[model samples]
Target: MDELARRSFVAAVLGAVFFGGPAVAQNTTAGGVTRVALKGYDPVSYFTDGVPQQGSAEFTFAFDDTTYWFKSAEHRTTFAADPEHYAPQFDGFCAVLLSRGRKVEADPEAWTINNGKLYVFSGKRGVLSFNERPIDIAQRAGENLKQLR
Candidate 1:
């Protein structure tokens, strides 16, 4: 195989084995669970109601190999209009864990929206640590996500 093709093949294999699937597989984590981003929470609610509202499968949209639930057709439309703007950072994985270069399940109830970005936590500890140093941790998490994506 040619060098470029070989490099791409190797990268694809390594990414799938180490980081789930392709870089667009941001909805998934390293643990191999094709996690539904925000865990069925209504992404629009965070902006509209300022809370994490449970979403219904009836109002859903599929993106990046993951299904996102919404509270209403309006919410679904809103999300579909601009998923990147609404989707959680690091595919809804714990922001704190991402900062530490780890992938873990997130607790929907434990969330934060910093500068129009949604970030969820795996647990209370994640929330605490993220809150303690949000800027630095978020920066590190952003860098880590760049590599993952």
Candidate 2:
């Protein structure tokens, strides 16, 4: 297979294993248009301005066949306004691993926020593990992300 094809195929497999769905669901706004969360329920719109916007500003990357939206237009306007507060770490990756100085793809449903930073995990179970060591996980993830780049 060609390089791009190989990459696409790998991405597909990884997405399926990590995201837990072949077709990710798009979380919509109160108006019920545009996509958010890729396949999970974020509800940031309701929290921010009682409405969801077109997209998130932190990292606009397509995931699980859908686009992930942000907290509000303010998120887009500033691009750094509470980034850790809104942006999913490690591109929506597993939080526990982040805390362990590693990065792994996560299931959208498994999520939590600490110090305003959004953390995603492989599943509810992983989240539990993360909860057990929030500070350590946060510190490790912060240090590990630099190496990933």
Candidate 3:
């Protein structure tokens, strides 16, 4: 098959195996629409406010079929300018789990900004584990991500 077709086939297979639903569900919860990204927490606020601020549906944007809410028009504009810079690492998956070559749901409230990258954890333990060695865990997760991607 052609390269494009082969890649599409592989992506489809991976999406089915990993997500068990539409590929867009990788960003949302079970491919549902009401499930907002980062659990409705403003992505920009994590940096600008140094905390997780709940966002409103009024200021929102949809990317990759997942909705991202913002606290204000300014924050929404900032996120629109460059979402990759503000979005949670590993697509909001538990960073510590990813470091161990696993995929687990993350708790938006349990997170940290390390080296300008936002990492969410499944719980307090995952946060502490990731904190123990951010660089090392990041390296390990990077290695795993290569194969997964």
Residue 51, candidate 3: Cα error in Å is: 1.1
* Residues 1-149, model 2: lDDT tens digits: 34575457446544553555442223343567744442433425423653323443443323323345544434332323233345566656576776676666676656666666667787789878878888887678777876764
Write one digit per residue (lDDT tens) for candidate 1, span 66-126.
6677888778767766666888877677899888888776888898888888889998777
| CA-lDDT, candidates in order | 0.74, 0.53, 0.73
In model 2, the runs with Cα more than 4 Å from the true position are 1-81
> Which candidate's TM-score is highest?
1
- Full candidate order by lDDT, most accurate first: 1, 3, 2
lDDT of 3 by residue, 1-149 (tens): 34575456445534443454432212345545355668888888989999899988777654434567888877866765566688887767777888889977688899999889898888988888998999888788878866665
Better of 2 and 3 by lDDT: 3
**Which number leads on lDDT?**
1
Better of 1 and 3 by lDDT: 1
* Alpha carbon RMSD to native, model 3: 8.9
Residue 88: error of model 3 in Å? Answer: 0.9
Among all windows of 10 consecutive residues in model 3, the one with the lowest summed lDDT is 20-29
Error of 2 at 138 (Å): 0.9
